[model samples]
Target: MVQESFEFVVYMIHACATKWNRLPSFVYRKLAESGCIQKFLVPNYEILHTQSTDFVVSDIEEYLNVRKVAI
Candidate 1:
């Protein structure tokens, strides 16, 4: 039962992020806690084996839009 519940929560996170097309920072934390998103993300191309293809969207405050907590 516990495993089933955890799977459901992960699915919800992907659904909300992919279906809705946007997610808040706090939501991302919950998703990570539920094993939904990456536990550790490398922002730069410092990892030689992997290629960084992510495009960051930052506003005037110079913060990743996805990392901003909605209050």
Candidate 2:
């Protein structure tokens, strides 16, 4: 991944962790297992990175929800 996208991934992982009251590692694992990192976040980085953190988090939540992934 490029530097910005990599950084964005890390930021999102931590953001999700905080919002979900989980550890960053756990969030990363959840996102990875659900393909959120690869299929959603990174692929949509150009647009997502421009949004508010809460907005992005909401988007992630929706994505996970549709996939039946609990936080």
Candidate 3:
């Protein structure tokens, strides 16, 4: 449940980024402080070799779907 909520927030962040071309600095800082920047967005590059904002959003969506199925 908690994970799902977190992923939803991450998805929203990426969705905003995709629309804006980049996340605002303040928003990015807040997300970084919350650890989402490191845990979800960063690790994706290590595993997939791509960290484009669109890819990040897709990754979060995929993760959320997988978690939903697990439930």
Candidate 4:
């Protein structure tokens, strides 16, 4: 389930980038550096050996909030 959520987020990011004619890797790196992506995965590293779904969801929500503020 966690993997599925991660994949879904990745796919959405890629799709949005592609729609905007941006490079997915570049966008992904930018998001990562901004703490908008992938950072949540570390929180549950010990327990799940992967990111917790809850953490990932919260991270995404926080990312959206940040984006809303920036815009």
Candidate 5:
């Protein structure tokens, strides 16, 4: 990943962790297992990284919800 995308991934991981009241590692695992990191976030980084953090977090939550992924 490019530097910016890498940073965004890290930021999103922490953001999700905080919003979900989970640890960063747990957030990372959930995202990875659900393919959110690779299939969603990173692929959409150009546009997504430009949005507000809450917006992105909401998007992530929606993605997981649609997939019926817990956490």
Candidate 6:
């Protein structure tokens, strides 16, 4: 089951945000805190303990900066 539309949306968003950088984190935190969005977003183990593709320390710092907070 390939999702071309979903992938296109993600890629377009990421590409446009590369210069802005903080957009993803804003989205991530909002999604992470919400039941519906979080279900489709990154999982807890990877977000908290692993530095895989999208959930790394740099990403955390970027996200914190957007919220004007730190971890």
The C-alpha lDDT values of all candidates are 0.37, 0.94, 0.54, 0.54, 0.95, 0.42
Candidate 1 lDDT score at position 8 = 42
Badly placed stretches (over 4 Å) of model 5 are none
Q: Global CA lDDT of candidate 2, please? A: 0.94
Ranking by TM-score: 2, 5, 4, 3, 1, 6
**Worst 10-residue lDDT window, candidate 3:** 62-71
Q: How well is each residue in 1-71 modelled by candidate 4, as lDDT tens digits? A: 37765766576456546654678876566567666645543343344335455554445546656766221
TM-score of each: 0.33, 0.97, 0.36, 0.47, 0.96, 0.29
Cα deviation in Å at residue 13, candidate 6? 1.6
Off by over 4 Å in 2: none
Candidate 1 at residue 36, lDDT?
Answer: 29
In model 3, residue pairs whose N, Cα or C atoms come closer than 3 Å (at least 3 residues apart or on different chains), thus clashing, are none
- RMSD (Å) of each candidate, 1 decimal: 13.0, 0.6, 10.0, 6.9, 0.6, 12.5
Off by over 4 Å in 4: 39-71
Question: What would the per-residue lDDT of candidate 2 be over residues 1-71, giving only the tens digit for each residue?
Answer: 78999999999999989988999999999899999999998899999999999999999999999999988
Better model by TM-score: candidate 1 vs candidate 5: 5
Q: For residues 1-71, what per-residue lDDT tens digits would candidate 1 score against the true structure?
A: 24544454344444445543666455566545543233222222134114322222212112323555331
lDDT of 6 by residue, 1-71 (tens): 13543453354335434634658665444434543123332333333333343443445446446656532
Query: For this target, which candidate reaches the highest lDDT against the unseen true structure?
Result: 5
**Which model is ahead, 4 or 6, in terms of lDDT?**
4
Please report the TM-score between candidate 6 and the true structure: 0.29
